[model samples]
Target chain A: MFDDKFLPQFEQIAGYIHDGGAVAIQQILHAGRYGGIDLGYCVQPSVVPQTLPHFRQPREVSKEQIKAMITQHAEAAKRAIKAGFDGTEITSFMGYLLANFNSKFTNRRTDEYGGSVENRGRFMRELIYAIKEAQGDDHPLIVRLNGAELMDAHGGNTEDECFELMKMAGDAGVDMISVTVGWQEAPESSIGRDIPPGHWNRLAVRAKQLLPNIPIAFGVRLPNPVMANQNIADGEFDYWEVCRPLLAEPELLHKAAEDRLDEAKHCLGCMNCLSRLFRDLPYLCTNNPTLGHEVEPEYHITPAVVKKKVMIIGAGPSGIECAIAATKRGHDVTIYEKSNSIGGSLVGYAAYDMANKEDLRSQISYYKTMLDKLGIKVNLNTDVNPKLMRSILHQYDVAVVAAGAGVDTRGLPIPEQEGVLVTAADVAGGKVKVGQKVVVLGGGKIGLTLAEGLSQTGREVTVVEKEKRIAGDVIPTWKWRHTSWVEQLKIKTLTLSKPIKIGASGVTIVNEKGEETFLQADTVIAASPRRPNQELFQEFEFMVDELHGIGDALVPRGLLQAIHEGYRLGVRI
Target chain B: MVSTADEMFLDTEGWQAILDRRQEIFTDMLPGASLGILPKKNFDSPVGTMLTWVRQADRMEVAYQSFTGFENTSVDLLMVVDDETLEYLHSQAQDNAFNEMKEQIRNGNVLLYVMKTLDELLDLGYEELIEVLKIPVLGACR
Candidate 1:
C-alpha cells in the first residue's frame, strides 16, 4: 500500500548508490497482521490477538481481500523493477503479511489458503509465482523465509514445516532462499550476546539441504568473519548475510580481504542496533558511534588542514581513542599511561572474566595495533604530576587529561573494626590478596564482577550492598546475563544491608529493617563508587594554551560515553 | 583474618591462577545441559550471581527467570529454590494461559526443584545437580 509513494524515492536511492559490481535488490513486504499497528488496523488471514501490548489486533481477511493483497504484492514487485532494481526479495519471515499467512498460528481459515502445509504456503507460492511472471525467469527473485519460526508454543511452524514451506517456495520458482531465524512472537532470544558464534548456522545448513539448487543466504548473530568463512567453507550456506556487523565496521570485508582482521572493529552483539530499530529510531552502534552518520562528511576523519602536536595522558579507551583519531587527522600524538598496558580498566576487567575476555582483548588488540601502525608515541609507567604537566605543556600544542577515576576506599566507620579493606580496583588489577571467605561491599557492576570472579575460584564470596539490586547500571539487554551468571556461581548477595563495621574476622551489617548480622570474612573488598581524578587537569589548565579534560578525568562514566567524548575532542581539535 | 595495615593481597600471578581455576571448572563441566534458575526477586543474590557466571562461562546452557516477571519458557529445566518463586509458579499454574507449563509439570516433563538455601544447592555440584534434576520425577511436580 505504501509502495505507490515510495517508488520515486526508491528510484532516487538506486540512482545515487554505486557500489561497484554489487547488484541492488529491492525487498518488499506487507506488514500483514503486523502492519499498520500505528493506524490501529491490519489485514491478516485470521484475527490473531497481539502478544505485545503496543501492537493492535488485525482484522480478518476475506477471500476477495486475499486476492487483492496478492495482486498488490505483484504490483509492488513490478514497481521495484521499474525503479531500476536488479531483483526483488519477497519477505515471508518474522510475522510479516506473507509469514502470518504461512503460519498455522495466524492462518486458521479453512479456505484454499489454509490448513495443510501446501495450503498454508499457498499465499507465498502465489506471490512468488506472480513476482517471477512480472519479471522474466532470469530476473533475480529471492524469497526470505524463517528456516524455523521458533514459535512452536505459539502454534507456529516447526523446522520441518519451514523446510516444507521453503520447498514450496522453490517449487514456485524463487531463485534464492534467504534463511532467517525466529519470529516476532518467538519467546527466546534468537540473536543476542547470549547466542554463541556460529550457533545458528545449523538452521541455514538445514535450509541448504532442502533447497539444494537454490543459493542460500544466512545471518543471525554471526559477527565473527572467520567463523562465517568457516561456515561457508563447510557448505552451511552459499552466502554469509551481514547487516549489524557492517554497522559496527563498514570496512569489514575489505579488512578481511587484506588480512587485517585484528584491525577490523567487530560487533559486540550488544543489541543496541536492534533496540534502536524496535524504538522506531535509526540504527546506532555502541562500539562505533559514527555508524548512522556514514553520509555525513564531518563524521569521516579526513586529513587536518592544520595539524598540531597532541599529548594525551592515560592510555584508557578514551585517551587511546583521542590519540588514534588525532593521529589519523595527520597530527603528532603521544599517550602517557601510568600503567604498562594500553587498556587501563579494560585490561583488568577483561582479565577477570573468561567469557567476555577474548572479545574485550580483541578490542584492545585492535587499538594497540592501530597505535603501532599510526606510529603514535606511547610512554608507559609515567605518572603526570605538576612538574610533568608543566613539561608536557611546553612540548605539545594541546594537552588532554584522561587520568581516569580512582576507587573510593573510605569505608564505613566503626569503633572496634580492624579488618583489611581493599578497593575493587585493586582486586580487578590483581594486586590485593583475597582469602577463602571474602565479603565485597557495594553490589554495583564492579562489586558483582569482583564477587563473581572470586566465587568462581571456589571461594566463599558474599556481596553486601545498601541498594536493593546488583548491576543496576547494566544495559537492559545484558542484565539477564549478569543475573544468570551470579545465580550460577552461587555468589551470595545481601541487598538493603549497610556495612556497619569491618572487624578482624567479620563485618557487621545492618539491614534496612533494623536487623543486625555478622558476616564472617577473611578479606573485605570495597567495591564502592569512584571519584574523578582531576587534580592534574586543574593544575595544567592555566599552564597550557590548549587544555582539555576528557573521559574519567572530566567525569567518571562508561566506555561508550568516554569513547564518544574522546572522538568529539579528536575531530574538533 | 589479619590487621587492617598487615593484610595481604593476591598479586597478578595469584589472580591468574584463580582465572585458570575458573576456566578449568567451566571446561570440565561440558557437554552441559540447560539449567534454569528462577529467583523470587530481581536483585544481586547468590542465585543471580551464579546464573551470571554460568552464562559468562559459555560452557553451560543456563536460563534465569525472575519471579516478579515471566519473559520466556524456552528453558529445558526450571529451578525454584525459594518459597516466593514456588508460590509464583503455583499462581501461574492456576491461570489457564499457562496450561503448557501445568501440563509439563503434570507429565513429569519439567524439571522442578525447591532447595532450602544457596549452600545446599551448591553442595550438589554441577554434574550431580544435572543428574538429579534432569531425571523425570513422578510425584515431585505436583
Candidate 2:
C-alpha cells in the first residue's frame, strides 16, 4: 500500500477474480499484535507483552504513527479500488492492530484514543470513516469486529463493549459488519468441533438486533449450509461468512446449490489446518486430503488408463474413501468388511467420543453416500483372508489392505478371560458387555475416550498408563478436552503406572515408585498397543499383481493419515 | 507487599499475604473461585504434591490437599509446574522464577492468570472460565 508498484499484482488478482464473475473484496489485513512475523517486534496500541510465546514482543505505536497507519489504510483501500475491486474491508478480528485499539486488554492510551468505550473504539470508527471516504460511497466498506473477544479474564473487551464497537461501526455508515469470535491467545475454543454448531448464533442474533440497518455476516462454528440457510431464514444474520469450511471442500457452495450436500466433504473442525498455520506450515485438512494440493496433477482424479477391478478390504474411513475415489476414476471398486456395518474402528470411537461425534459420523455418512452414488459394491460381514481370497483369486486386479489396526492382545498383562476381559473395540462396537467396575489399560486418546464415556454412563472407570501423562497420542487441539473430560467425569487416571495382574474382583496396578495398588474392577479392557494387520501382505504376496497396504493396515495411526493414504493410493491406482 | 514472584509464592506465609491483600477482589467474586496448584518434581513424571486456595469473604483459605490429579479435583483455576520452574521457585531465584513461570504458562504447564475486575470474574461462568482462562484444560481445534 505504501507503493503503487504493487498495483499491477493486485490488478492481475482482481482480474482473475472478475473473470470468474465473482465480486472480489480486497481485505486490507494489518495483523496488529500478531504482525511482524519475521521482525523482532510487533506494533500494538499499548506495549502489552504477548501471552503466546509464538508472537513477537510488542512495541507501542505512537500517536503520530497511528495517524500514518490510518492514512496508509485509506491509501490501501484506494489502491484496491484502482485494482478493480468491487469493495474493501478492514479487519479488527483476531486481536489485530485494530482489535488492539478496541480491546482494553491492549489499549492503554491516555489520549483521545483510550479510556472510555467510545475512546477505545475511536480508532476503528475513524478507520471505517476514512476507508469509506477514500473508496467512496459507490464502493461498500465492511468492518470485521469481534462479537465476543472471550478475553474477559485478561481485562479484554466485555460483550457489551464488543457490541458498542459494532454499534459504532454501524453508526459510522459501514456497509456491513462481519462479526467474528475469540482471539488467538484466548483460552477457550470459539470455533473448535467441541463447540456445537449454531452455538454462537445468539451472537449473530444480538449483532443483527443492535444494527438492524447494517448487513451482518457470521459463520463462527456454523458449518453446514443447510443450517446457515435456516439461520438466514430465521434472521440470525444476513450472510454466512465461511472460510475454513470452504478450505475443507472448495465445492461446498456448489454441492449445496445442487442439493447434493451428502456428497460434500464436511469440515471436521479438527483444527489441523490452524495447527499447521500456527506452526508456520502449509495448511492441510484431516478429512479433505487434497486441500493444499489444488494445482497438483496427482491429486486430481482422472479416468484410469485401464479400468481394473479394485478390491478394498475394511470398509472404514480409509477403505471407503479409496472405494469412492477409485470408482470416480472409472475403476470397478468393491469394499469388504468383517463387521456388519461399514465404519471400522472409527464407528466404535465415535460412539464414545466426547467431542462432536456428528462431525466424525458425518465423514462416514459422506463416504456411504459417495459409495452408493458411484455404485461401489460393499460386502459387509465378509472378512478378507487367505482362504477368502483363494475363492476369488483372480477376481481383483489390485488388493488394497485398508483392514486397519487392532489392539495387541498379546501385549496385555493378563490373559483373556471370558466375560471378565474385553477389548476396547469390542466394548465400543457393543459386541461385548462390561461389568459395573471397569479397568481400561493404556491412557492415550483411545483409553481416555472410553473411560470418559463409561464414566458418563455411571460406570466406575479407571485408566492405567505407563507414560508420565495421558493424551500423548491425542492431537494438540483436543488434548486439553480429553484431560478436562476425564477430570469432570471423575475418571481415575493412574499415570506412570500399568496393570500388573487381572482377577475376577479387580486389577493390581504398579506405579513408578515400585509400589503395587489394588484397584477393584469387574472388567479389564485392553485399549492400547495397536498392531497393524500386515499378515495379509505376506499371505497374498503371490495372489495378486498389486498388493498394496494403506491406513492402519500399513501402520497404526489416526484418521488424517488413513484418509490421506487411501486417497493418494486411489488416484495412482 | 511481596517483592518478587518467588517471594510471593515460595512459602505459606507469602500465599496468605497475597490472599489478604486481594481479599476484597476475591470476596466480590462468586463462590467456587478456588484455585488448585500442582507442582510436579519433574515435567515428564507425575508427582503427588498439591496446594489449594479457596476464596472466603475476608481472605482465601489456603491448604495442602491430598495430591489427586486434576480429574478428581474441582477448581476454577489450576496451575501445574515443571521441574525447572519448581527449582526456580524453591531456589528463590526471582527473575528466573518469573520468566520460567511465563514460559511454562505458554507451554500449558503453569496456568497463571491475573483477574483485573470483580465484574470480569463475576460475569464469567464455569464453562467460560474453562474455555477462556489460560488454565490449560486443552480443547480447541481451529
Candidate 3:
C-alpha cells in the first residue's frame, strides 16, 4: 500500500494511527552509506546527482545547508498535513540521514556541526524548527536518537549531552522522544549485537528522568514479547521499536494480540536482512521466505501447486528451504537426507540455547509441518551423486543442491600431539573428547560459537585470534552479544596472538609483543576456520542438467548470510 | 584549472567540446526557445547562464567559451555515451567529467550517473530550460 509514496504518504497510514490515536512516527529512511552504499534502488541515486545539490553525500550540513534540509523537511511535513497525517516525526531512528549527521565517527568536521554535544546537534535543532513551523505549533514532533554509539569513534556515551539534546528537543517543540543505542555506521552493533537485551532501554529511562515531562522510548530486537511487556511494567522503557524482529515477522503485532505467543515468529538477532540491504538485494529470514517478495504471485503459495513431484538433496538449511519452497509451490517434494534424520549441521547448532537454536529449530519445524501438509516423502539414510541421483533428475522436474558441507579439517601446517587435536566439527558432534582445558585456533563464528559452548561447559578455554579483533566478519550485533557473553564467562581471548605449537601438556602461543607463553590445555581444537566444502560440491560439478550453488559452498560464514542467499534464490525461480 | 586527481588527466576544454558535440547530436530532441543572443558571449561562467521559457520541439541555445574547445552537450551523456563515436568525443572532452562524473563507478563515483545529468541540464542551454521544466502534472493543471 505504501508504494512510491513520498513523505505525504504517511497521512494514509496515519488514518489508522489517528483513529486509535496511535503515535505517528516519521520513520525517516537514511542511507548511512548515502550514495556510497547501494541502498535498495540504484535508480534513486541516478535520479539526482551530487551536483544536483540534493544528491550531495548527506554530509554534515553547514548551518546554511542544514537550514535548507530543515526547510525541505518542513515542506514535507506541510504536505503530510495536507494529506491528513495527525502528527509529524522528524525521523532520527534506524540510522537514517539525520543519524549520519549525528554520528561522531562519520562526522569528522571540526565545525559547529561536529565535535561537542551542543555544537553537534546544530542541524537537528534547525530541523525541529522546520517541523514546528510546519505543524503550526501544537502537534507532536518526536526525535529518534541513539542512547549510545556502538562504535568507539562516535561518542555515543555523551550521557549528559544526550540528556541535554532530549531537553532541547522537548523545549524546541519536540512532542516526544525515543532513545536507542548504537549508530547506523555499525547497525549490527545497534540492534542487539553489541548490547544485551533491553540494553538501550535503560537509556530512555535516563532520558525520561532528565526530561520528565516528555515521553521517551527505546529500540531493541526483543523477541520475547513477555520481556517487552514486563520491561514496560518495570518502568524500564516507554515504547519499543522492534526493527529486526518485525522484519523477521511483520504479523508479530496482530499475533501477540491473540495471545498466541508461541506462534510469534521471532527475530534470531541475525543480520541477513540488513546485510542484503547493503547490496540492494531482497530481505531474507532465517525462517520466513515470504519477506520482501510480497509483490510476487507466488509470494504466499496456494494449494494448487502442491501436487507436482519435487526432489531436494542434502538435508542442510538451504536444501530444506528448497524442498519447503518446492512443496509450497504445490509440488510433492521429497527430501533425501544422507544422514539418518533431518537437521544437518543445524543439529549441533540447535543443541545450544533456544536463542542460538531458534532459527534452526523453527525452520526445521516449518519444513516438517509443510512436508506433513503436502504428504511429501522424506528418505533418510540416503546419499546421492551423479549416477545414483540420475533417477531423481528423471523423476522430478526440479532438483535442489542442498547437500550439507563435507568435513573440512584444513588446519595449521604446524604439528600437534596425537589425541590432543580436535576439529571444531568433531567437538560439535560430540565425537571428540576434550580434556579439562582447551585452546581454540580459529576466531570465525563457528570457532567462536564452539569456544563459547565449551566455556559454558565449564571448560577452561583460551581463544587466540590472529586478527586485532576476534569477530570482524560476524555481524556487529552478534559480535557484541557473543563477545560480551564470552567475556562474562571469563573466556580468555588473546587478540593479535598466534599459536606457536601444540603439545600434549598444553599449547604455546606468541603474544603481540613476541612474548611466548604456554597455556595449559589438554586438548586443542583445530577449527582452522574452514574454507568451502569442495569435496561435496565437486561431486555435482556439472553432473546435472542444471546446477546452482549457495551457502557455505560460496564461503563459510554465519547462518544469516546463507539464509539470505538461499531465500533470494528461492524467489528467483 | 579543474584538474583530475594524480596522473589522471582532465582537459576541461576538450570535455566542453565533447559536450558541445552531443548537444548538436541531440539538438532536435531538445526544446527550443528564443533568447537575447549576445553573440560569442561567455558560456563557462555560471552568470552568463540564463534560462528562458520557450516553445519548440527541442530545447536550444548556442554559445562559445574561453576554456572550451567548442562547447558541451551534457555530463550525464558523457558518462554513458551511446557509442564509440561518443566515447571518442568524450575522450576528446579531455575527460574532465571523468573525475566529476564517470560512465562507471570504480573508486567512489556513484554520483557520476546524476552528475552527468546535471551537466546535460546545463549544456541544454538556458533559452528553453523553463519550458522543459514546466512539467505539466495532471493535478497541477487544475
Candidate 4:
C-alpha cells in the first residue's frame, strides 16, 4: 500500500477476481493505535497511548503529516483503480487510524483536526474528497464507520455521535457506508458466538433511518443469509456485508442462490479466526476444515480410485465429517452410533452450551443433512464393539475409529454408594439424574459449561479443579467468556483442589495447601482427564483390511481437532 | 545511583522504579490532577501509599511518600496492581516488562479507578489509563 511496486500483484489479483465475474474493491486500512508493530510507534491525531499491549505507543500526527497522509490515501486509491479495481474502500472500523482521528477519546488535538464532531470528521472528509478526486466519478468509494463504538466507558463517541459521523460521510458524497460495531478494545462481545445473530440489526436500522439516500451495508454478527435478505427487504440496509460466514463456507452465497442454504455450513461465531490473528497465526475456522489449507491437494476431496467401503464408528462431528468426505470422494461409507442420535458427545455438549446453542446444534444439523444428501448410511443405536466388528469381519474394507473421547472416571475416588458418581457425559446427555447439591470434578470447558448451566437452574454447584486455574484447556479467545459466566452465575470454584473421596452425601477435597475440605454434593461428576476411545483401532485392526483412528479417538480434544483430523483422514483414505 | 534535587525515600524499590520508568505520566497530568497507585492488598481502603507528582512554580516534582488518607489530598485516579504483577514487571526487560504490564492492565489484573467518582475506569479497562494520561507505555509484540 505504501508504494506502486505491488501494482503488478494487485493487477493479477484484480484480474483473477474479474475473471470470476466479480468486482474487486481494494480496502486500504491503516492500523492507527493498533499499528507500528515494527517501528514501535503509531501515528495519531493526538498523543494517545495504546490501551492494549498488542499495539504500539502512539506519536502525535502534525498538520503536515495529516496532509501527507491524505495525499498518500489518494495516491493509493489511484493505484488501486489503475491496477483495475472497480472501487476502493477506506475503513475507520475497529479503531484504525481513521477512527483514531474521528474518535473523541483518541483525538485530543487542540487544532482544527480535533474537538467537535465536525472538526474531528474533517480528516475523513478531506480523505474522501481527495480519494474521490483521484479515482474519478466512475469508481465508487465505500466508507466503513462504526455505528456503535461500544467504548462509552472510555468517553468514546455515543451512538448519536456515531450517526453524526455517518451523516458527515454521507454528506461528503461517499457512494456507500458500511456500518460496523465495536472496537478491538471494546470490553463487551461483538462478533463472538455468545452474541446471538441479528443482535446488531438495530444499528443497521438506525443507519438506514439516518441516511435514507445513502446505501448502507451491514453484516456484523449476522451470519444467516436468509435473515440478511429479509432484513434488506425490510429496509434495514441496502447490502449485506458478509465475511466470516463466507470464510466458513465459501459457497455460502451460491448455496443461498440455489436455495441450498440448509446444505451450507454455518459460521459458529467462535472467533477462532480473530483469535488466531491476535496470536499472529494464520486464520483457522472451527467449522471449515479446508479454510487455511485450501491449496493443499490432500485437504480437498477427490474421487477415490479404489472405491472402498468405509465403516465409521461413533456418529459425532469427526465420524460424520469423515463419512460425508469419503462419500463425496465416491467411497461407500456408513456410520455406526451406540446412541439413539447421530451426534456423539457433541449432542450432550450442545445441550449445556451457554453461548448460542443453535450454533453448536447447527453443526449436527449440517452433518445430518450432508450425510443424507451424500447417500451415506448411518445406523443409530448400533454399537460398533469388538463383537460387531467380528460379525462384520470382511464386510467393510476400511474401519474408522471416530468414536470420540469420553470422561475417564477410573481416576475418580471410589464412590461409597453405587450411583453417587456419574460421568459428565451422562449428566449432560440427561442419562443420569442430579441432586440439588452437585460437585463437578475438573474445571475445563465441559465442567464449567455444566457447572454454569446447572447453577442457572438454581442448582447448588461447585467446580473443583486440580490445576491452579480453570480453562487451561479452553481456547484463548473463549477463556474470558467462561470465567465471566462463572462469576456472573455465582458458581463456586475451588482451584488447586482435587476430590480425595466421594460419599453419598458429599465429597472430600484437598487443596494445594494441604487443607482438607468436605463439600456436600449429591452427585460428583467427572468431567475431565478424558482418554480417547482407542480400543476400536486395536479391536478392528485384524478384522478390517484397513483400520485408522481420527479425532478424539486418536487423542482427546475439541471440535476443531476432531473435524480437521476427520477430513484429513477421509481425504487421504 | 544518580542524585536529583528532589529525591525522596519510598517504601519499596518497585514504586520508585515505576515512577522512574513512567515519569511522563506525571508530566501530562494537569497541575491539579493527582493519581494514586493502590496495591491489591490494601484495595479496601479509599487511599494508598502515595507515589505522586506535584507541579511546582516552574518544575514538576516527583514525590514518593506514605499514605496520607483520601481526604488529605485531591486524587484524580487510582490504579491498583497486584504485588505479583509489580514483581513481574521487575523481572523482565524494560520493553517486555511494560508490554506484560499493559496486558495485565487489559486483563483486569491491574485495575484502574477514577478517584473522584469512586467508579472503576472502563475506558481501556486497566490499560486505558495510559491513553488518558498520555503515558507512552511501550512495546509491540512484533
Tens digit per residue, CA lDDT, model 3, A52-113: 21122332245565566667777766666666665667655434556555554344556767
TM-score of the A chain in candidate 1? 0.92
Looking at model 2 chain A, which ten-residue stretch has the lowest summed lDDT? A48-57
lDDT of 4 by residue, A1-573 (tens): 669999999999999989978889999888887777678667888764445555665678889999999999999999999999999999987889999988997888789989999999999999999999999999999999999997775568999999999999999999999999988777678888898889999999999998999999999999999999999999999999999999999999989999998899989888888877865679899889999898989898999989999999989988988888888899999899889998888888888888999998998898888988888898999988888777778889998998888889888888999998998989988999999999999999999989988988899999999987788798877877787788778888999998889988999999988999999999889999998988777666789888889888888889999888888889989
lDDT of each: 0.70, 0.80, 0.55, 0.80
Q: Which ten residues in a row have the lowest lDDT in candidate 4 chain A?
A: A48-57
Q: Model 2 off-target regions past 4 Å?
A: A1-5, B1-142
Which 10-residue span in candidate 1 chain A carries the lowest summed lDDT? A48-57
Tell me the deviation in Å of residue A223 in model 4: 0.4
Give the chain B TM-score achieved by candidate 3. Answer: 0.23
- List candidate 4 segments past 4 Å from native: B1-142
Q: How many residue pairs clash in each candidate?
A: 25, 7, 29, 1
**How well does each candidate superpose onto the true structure, as a TM-score?**
0.77, 0.83, 0.58, 0.84
lDDT at position A318, candidate 2:
86
* Residue A365, candidate 3: C-alpha displacement in angstroms: 6.2
Task: Identify the candidate with maximal DockQ.
Answer: 2
